[model samples]
Target: MALTFTEEQEELRTTLRRFLADKAPSAAVRRAMDSDEGHDPLLWRQMADQLGLHGLALPEEYGGFGGGPVELGIVLEETGRVLLPSPYFATVALAGQALAASNDEAVKARWLPAIADGSTTATLALAEASGSWRLEDIETSVGNGTVSGTKMFVVDGHTADLILVVARTDTGTGLFAVDGDAPGVTRTRLETLDPTRRLARVDLDGAPARRVGPDGDASPYLRTVLDLVAVALAAEQVGGAQACLDAAVAYAKVRVQFGRPIGSFQAIKHKCADLLVQIEGARSAAYHATAVAAEGSSELPVSAALAAACCADAFTHAAKENIQIHGGIGYTWEHDAHLYLKRAKSSEQLFGGPATHRARLADLVGI
Candidate 1:
């Protein structure tokens, strides 16, 4: 499908880009990353109150704009470009999407308004100690109205007000809602490569749990949710890739070597040109996936897999090439280049690596 944006979508991108450039500058990002909360709460409120970002893609009855994946993708792309340190992704992309996709109206009524108004932070806990994202691999068990298991690599798990936990039941895999501070729940922040994003390990020892979706096997619904999340993440990856490309090109134009701008050099020019192509390709893939998701197409599985692989590889490549173009400065801890590289490397493995997505794509297409 052709990747096109409406005028309103374009305006959203422009507005969000300007807002982030003002509110989430490099210094603000560093401050948030180093803070215990891992993000600026006041800034978070501003995003909801001023931009209605928290409700951009939520249902209208739940205090949102009744938008869809495409709208959410636009917000994510802008945030990724600035490397904004916030729980927005965990709250909206991971947990919000899951809740919105759930069949239980009670669950949505009880939780979504809090999320929409920015009063609650939430995350979806799927990966276990095995570090697997597959639903069938889940070993966490739920019995007698409680869930017991340890979840690893949970985004913002330590601090979220709500945690949507994936657990195995007698029938099949299911999603459970466990309060972050509920009795028997333990959340620990884990040391990670990307300071801009926080990850946690959650131990739910017979925690009182409320089933969020269907009563029986929810694997199919959960799978769709995962696909949606992958597409959302791809949007973010494209934004990050574009940022790296822009930074590299800008630096090349100003930093002179051999009595001329490095951008005039064939080697630097080639690297920048290549990065631009890769980023644009990734952008298209992400945009296409978002469009597929918004339309609820049957082609979603194929499109999501394609996007997951393409965008991850492109972002990682762009980040590395950006550093190389900047020479020694990019390698320094003081420079922002390393930050982008860290985010790229970490995000590449978040849902699964590029290779994993490609393997899934092959299976999906019966290749």
Candidate 2:
């Protein structure tokens, strides 16, 4: 609640920041985004092997450190700052969280260890052609141990080793595990504004599948998983917003206009000051949600919605103002400013956008 980090947390942030600076610099990020795999496999392995990042938030019984949302948020925020162009978010934040939150021990035992060790990549396929993130809007259905439907905007869907498909069943909404390469599964990479993060369309035509969670209504469990993920995404947005503010201030200090540094101008100073205030507010919102998630508090839903709305808006604003501060140079293909803006805009819409989150927040708070 105080938004203060422990000493260890600060160390973790420092280590990850240094690592990203060395391994995931601008050129490296560009290379990975342009490559077919969309990320460096070697770096991915190193993250698991050296840093144990993939397992930081997983249960120790599943070959992890048994950390929670707070630890995962730290990792995500660091990765987001660099726009690392990796499937870490899809593999760990999305699928890993879903499996961990499920009611099936067998499912967790079968999949979580692989995820912790970074041996497998996976993603949750929730949104579809209808362009909705709500469980009630899901049209994918399961029958006779098979799933059939088209899932769009699946993060890392084309390359993930496993696909956790949210499908409709006679009982209620359920989670189905379908092997990425299984028969009757078709995956197509989609062209997106944010090339740093890849998305895909997955078509399942009677794909063999096994139910991962309860046979009865699993909507409640799925909703909790979604809330946790929203908090994690908010952490990432905070990092991106902070980066934009830093970049803008740094550029304003150096770039000259009217025989003086632009940062010395009152308008530029006001913009920087406003961005700092917004970023700090967003950071507090994200940190509070992370704490609530770690505590498994009943307030997670409200906190998550609040974080999602605040952080998304803050990140987008920071990115836009960052571009504005840099003037014409920021608009160029060679500049990294545009990439940050693209990531901000793309992530803002990833889980229903700021307006959707605000509406959810209002409904949850009975306002």
What CA root-mean-square deviation does each model show from the true structure?
A: 0.9, 0.9
* Candidate 1: stretches off by over 4 Å: none
lDDT of 2 at 239: 88
TM-scores for the candidates: 0.99, 0.99
Q: Which 10 consecutive residues of model 2 have the lowest summed lDDT? A: 1-10
Clashing pairs in 1: none
Which lDDT tens digits does candidate 1 get at residues 13-109? 9999999999999999999999989999999999999999998999999999999999999999999998999999999999999999997899999
Candidate 2 residue pairs that clash: none
Error of 1 at 208 (Å): 0.5
